[model samples]
Target: MAYDLAPASVMFADVADVESAEMEIVHWDGGISIVPSGPVITRDADGGELHRLP
Candidate 1:
């Protein structure tokens, strides 16, 4: 399962639009990492094939 990462208080002042967001599945050590291209609120788990946002 994946956990949510809260946004840092000190964010960019000149906030721009989000280009895109995606999830990545790492192969090494059988671990999973969620990488976001922009400022998002959620991520996906490693075991699942699809990502479901609430």
Candidate 2:
């Protein structure tokens, strides 16, 4: 997370991008978090799977 940027500013910017991209966001009773679906696999130069991110 970026401590320099205000939380609300980051959130609003991300929300705006999501809106423009037509992405989805989930609102829960506690708060909200949006996880882009599918397996985001990172590969090294050798084409080996290095990590899997959400």
Worst 10 residues of 2 by lDDT: 1-10
In Å, residue 11's CA in model 2 sits off its true spot by: 28
> Residue 32 error for model 1, in Å?
1.2
Candidate 1's error at 34, in angstroms? 1.5
| Residue 20 local lDDT, model 1 | 50
Query: Mind giving the per-residue lDDT tens digits that candidate 2 earns over 1-54?
Result: 111322333232222233344434565444444444443443434566644545
Q: Which candidate has the top score in lDDT? A: 2
User: What's each prediction's TM-score?
Assistant: 0.23, 0.29
**How do the residues 1-54 of candidate 1 rate in per-residue lDDT, one tens digit apiece?**
244334431111111244454444333333334454444343233333244332
Flag clash pairs in model 2.
none
